[model samples]
Target: MSEKIFSYLEVHAVDHCNNNCRWCNNHSPFCPEREYAAGEYIPWMEKLEKKGIEYDMISVMGGEPFLHKNLTGFVLELRRRFPRKSLAISTNGFWLGEEQIESYQMLWKLTDILFISLYPNLLRGLKDGGDVTPLLHKITKHNPHLKIDLRQKQTFRMIAYSEEPVEPNTFCGTSECTTLLADGRLARCGLGGYAGYSPNVGEAFRSSKHMFFDLNRKFSKGEFWNWRRRWPFDACYHCDSYKWRETNWKAEKGKRRRLDLELEHDRLAGGRLMALGNFTQAESLFRRTAEKYPLDAALCNDLAVCVSHREPLEALAYLAKALEIDPDHDDARANLRRLRHVLGRGTENARPEVCSADAGVR
Candidate 1:
């Protein structure tokens, strides 16, 4: 049987983040945009509830979910509406002090999980110190019954870039990976906004009156998993220990301003080589270019695909490397799935039989 594709909901309460970590991919501190107001949330919640769409899991994230003044109220409302549904939140955990903890007490009663971003630099007092470990431990200790995942920065992953892409890494490719922006836009994965594309979540939801309409339109019919375009990396992608390249979209000034230019050059060169079906040479060029700019997920993804036929094991290695850098890498994940199946069927030793004239590594 095919895998069941479960649907989940993510609501971005606010886009204005408080932390100013150097590796922040969305450039949170630099993001001068704010998405929603407290009043806006209730209506959306009501709409979802009226539709009888009980989300498998409702994920609350933002520049920081706790940044919202009504965070506690929001959690309570959600719990009140969907008593049996799972609730989760991702936060920098900076405001998680005594008062905040007390406020969260009500939330903890309903929340099933809490994902705290343990960015070393985001700790308190140590330049970018905003340690959440103590807070996380405290929450867990107090609740004792709550489940928590202390997500380190290294666990994130990225897809490969087409030009100088970065190495892959390990990640859990959740079947229900999806995100909902404050504007009600839906994306295939959590990193969609960071990756530079709008999956039109809000428009889909408003038009159809059902969240599944957007989900089915984007996944089943839209083939949302395919990565054919290019986008820069965000803080989550950069903080990922497995990441290789970094795109400073905010830096549009001097010598460093032309970073995208360098990436573009490599992309063009890499594309030409790939067009000739020269996987070996293309892989070599991509490897060298990626070394200088390791954050390009698209490039890394391409190199992995090129070498898959010639060297399945090597290709698997490259795909794994690409995934390490970008966990949301749909292509790398798909390719890795295929490679694993090929290797498992004991076809690793089998060679394709081709006519001599047509067999020239076509």
Candidate 2:
């Protein structure tokens, strides 16, 4: 991580988030609750010091940073270690109402910035039907010196799983935001760090590919730099950032979408099933869909994800066919790239035996 000086480093204080925002790329909706102790990450920082890595600032965030009961202690410890470094806490502010003003006042001394991201999901995710307005007022009353970055979402976009990925035009928000995970792993961004954590919520994370830095294990600095310059982590292709147009965020309490994300399209119905980790049903549907539309690149790509673990060769074939139909299919291309990288690296059995690649479709 110290290969280059970073503007700021982001760390998740809690594994699970309080709000299930549809636009979130953090995979928070699917993660379980776990507050990371500051002690766990202290060694990672010490390692960074030993390796000559440098970062200008540290941002404490999480599924929701406020979920950690000892966040003050955690931040206090970070401040104790890096007293000169700028510190920040990014949160949804859902728990602000419950915070003791004195606690935050004490936090004010350690924190330089307080980032609050407001998503419409807060209307429902709030406890006992409480709102953040009172919390906002309380903060305003304190006149805290920490810089406040409160952004009420006006338009929102999502990162979604799609077999047929669209041309990526969306800006990479995390391009410069290197993330540090609790296990002493450094990731290019939040998605890369947290994508693997989502299988607990659904099959989507399980079906996707991710990459990270293992400072605790063997790694190639050259490989890491090369991987950094290459395609956005394979998970980037699964992002709906560019596929779906940004929609106006509806803030009206009565009109907020239910907790379940609405299906964006009927043809991609299998995706919803896949979201629930229903690969068996998704596989059946995708196979049937591919049989009907053999040239459909999207269906081929979906089928590839469904069977990649069991029938790696067949998965390769489906991905190849998807590329054959549309050479520029980013989703299929990403899946193929993942296969090549994984099989080439082969964490298991030094690469599984792969037969010749052929979709063998009727």
Candidate 3:
């Protein structure tokens, strides 16, 4: 890669992971089973070299790097080509076994750092029945020189696509990700990279070869590295972020979690408008979101807040529905008490509280 391109770049050994994590930004679980040949990256790297791009590190990661058919050979070639480049390999030991010890040793000897993600499922005797946990400890025992970065992933960043109106210029925290996916496409980040692969994301932004940056273009370092135009095909409206629902870390197994993702995206969008005192737009958004995701109590609570001003009775019905769905809904409960007090005082026009997403935008 060119010095002008970036300091970091990631090359996946494969895109299809054994664990289908829902919060995965890369959308690994959604992708088909395929191993990336080291040869595919040669021209991409050479293009960067031609453009004078140099990077500080080249991270080798995967669905699981060990799943790659040509594991040792792949990194061996990368090490040969860029001997000075720092190589880091990220893996979950699900695919690793006693049989692959020699290959693991060779890999440990070759790479600078080994990142092991100790997901709860892996620790709780999942899949391989606690075989992987012990082998992870052995990495340092044998390869004393290799660095081990262990990550205890209890929480993950949520990546969701909105079915709502597009916002055009949304710059995400993930835009800084500079990884090349298994399809030989170098993307600004994994979220944009898995355009055609991710369940909801594919539907939101249809993937095309053109969306993937043209490596053949005679673009300068700044032109090559410009993230805005390249990511999400000009407008980043289809994607947005908000409060993540805290759920247990388990595999979605490539299941579509679109409804909840869209719920949060649309609800949060309405919440933002509610914060700006744009109750009209917020009301419209919340009602539309409710039609899409009717059973969610949070949406009901949020919807109640917006409609409270013009339709106190409708707001009461919405809040009642939220409470009926989830009796422990604190915001709905709190809004109900406040709404009742206003009615008892005969000041029904008084805006109660925009509780829930906006935390009662008064």
Order of all candidates by TM-score, from best down to worst? 3, 2, 1
Q: Which model, 1 or 3, shows the larger lDDT?
A: 3
CA lDDT, every model vs. true structure = 0.51, 0.65, 0.65
Encode model 3's per-residue lDDT on 1-362: one tens digit a residue. Answer: 43444666788888776666776766777877777877778668766766777787888876667666556689998888888889888886543333234334556678788887866755563336554556655666667777877776766666567655465454465655577754446776666676667666735445333345656556667766564235445324555643344566767753642345335546655665676677777777666556646457788889778888787777777776777678789898888778777668335334343335343322
Best by TM-score: 3
How displaced is residue 251 in candidate 2, in Å? 12
* Model 1 global lDDT (CA atoms, 0 to 1): 0.51
Q: On a 0 to 100 scale, what is the lDDT of residue 226 in model 2?
A: 64
Q: Residue 160 in model 3: shift from native, Å?
A: 1.7
TM-score of each: 0.45, 0.58, 0.60
Error of 3 at 162 (Å): 1.1
**149 Cα displacement, candidate 2 (Å):** 0.7
Off by over 4 Å in 2: 1-4, 97-99, 121-144, 164-171, 199-210, 218-233, 242-244, 248-362
Name the regions of candidate 1 deviating beyond 4 angstroms: 1-4, 21-27, 33-55, 96-99, 124-137, 154-176, 194-362
lDDT of candidate 2 over 153-262, digit per residue (tens): 65667455555444456657665567888788778777657767554223443344455667797555565556555555555665554455577654322233322221
User: Which tens-of-lDDT digit does each residue in 203-277 have in candidate 1?
Assistant: 222232212223312233123223211122222233233444444222212212223433544554455556655
Model 2, CA-based lDDT: 0.65
Model 1 lowest lDDT segment of ten: 227-236
